[model samples]
Target: MRIAMIAAMAKNRVIGRDNKMPWHLPEDLRHFKAMTLSKPIVMGRKTFESIGRPLPGRHNIVISRNSQLSIEGVTCVTTFDEAMTMAGDCDELVVIGGGQLYQQLLPKADVLYLTLIDLDVDGDTVFPEWDDGSWQLQNSVTATNDKGLQYSFNTLFKKC
Candidate 1:
């Protein structure tokens, strides 16, 4: 199964703050839906809670350390291994995250779908840095949202 990490980060690599995204870009939302449709998404419990519900048309797998935690309409796991086992033989599994999930899964990702935002925004959470030399850019397109925020939708493939 292919493992992909999808996120939008600001110029300063801020992906989130206080359990939420620091900025909203409609175009980026569209891009996220398109890329993740039909795939099983694995995220931390906080990430799942932040979204508030199961995303339609896809399976949601959440990892949390809380043993008593359970939510209807989604499978909840206590560890990453359980999440992987639940993911099974899917064509692709996307890690849609809050910072902690990204940090844990970065090394295992086979591809990255990133929305590179142009502005530097304040946030408590940041995306982890990676070595650029190990990945090859597969596709990229820059577009400006109605809010006039310039961003690029980029897909990068991890080198074998």
Candidate 2:
């Protein structure tokens, strides 16, 4: 399966604050939903809780060390390998993550769908720093949010 990552972060790489996204960008949210619809999405426990429920029209595979954890309509796994094994039949495996998961699996991903928010904000969670030389930009589209926040949805393919 081809692994891909999807995240929204500030220019400073802040993905979240207090267990939630720092900014409200509805357009980016819609973009995420559209891109991930019907795909198998892997995420860490914190990320799942932050979302509070399984996202409709997708397979939710959550990675957590907690083996006894179970959620209705969700599959919980103990390792990334487990998640990958379960999703192996899928043509594309999408990782929608919290900081730790992104840091651990970014190197394994073949594509990145990133929403680069224009403003910097204080946050407790951060997306990992990746080398620009390792990813080739495939597409980008910029748009402004209802609250005047500007952001770009960028798709980058990892260099082979």
Candidate 3:
């Protein structure tokens, strides 16, 4: 299966603050839903909790160290490896994030779907730093939100 990492980060790489996204971008949320719908999405426990429920129309796979934890409409796995294994015959597995999951899966990801928000906000969680040399930009589309926030949807492929 192909592994992909999807996230929206600010100019400073901040992804979340206080267990929630620091900014509200409905366009990005719509983009996320459209891209991930019907795909198997794997995320860490914190990411799942932040979302509060299983994302409809996609297979929800949550990775956590807690073996005994269970949630309706979600599959719980102990490790990233196990989560991938459980994804089965899916052509792509999108790794949704909380930070640590992004850090752990970056090296294994074949593609990155990143939304670059044009702002620097204070946050405790950050997207892991990655080498631009390792990824080739495939496409980008710039957009502006209703609140005047500018962002770009970027697709990058791991360079061969």
Best by TM-score: 3
Q: Whole-model Cα lDDT per candidate?
A: 0.91, 0.93, 0.95
How high a TM-score does candidate 1 get? 0.96
Give the Å shift of residue 106 in candidate 2: 0.8
Best by lDDT: 3
Sorted on TM-score, highest at the top, how do the candidates line up? 3, 2, 1
Model 1: lDDT equals 0.91
Taking all chains together, each candidate's TM-score versus the true structure is: 0.96, 0.97, 0.98
**Number of clashes recorded per candidate:** 0, 0, 0
Model 2, range 96-155, lDDT digits (tens) per residue? 998999999999999999999999999999999999999999999999877888899999
- Give RMSD (Å) of candidate 2 vs. truth: 0.9
lDDT, model 3, position 8: 97
Q: Write the per-residue lDDT of candidate 3 for residues 1-160, one digit (tens) a residue.
A: 8999999999999999998999999999999999899999999999999999999999999999899999999999999888888898899999989799999889999999999999999999999998999999999999887888899999999999
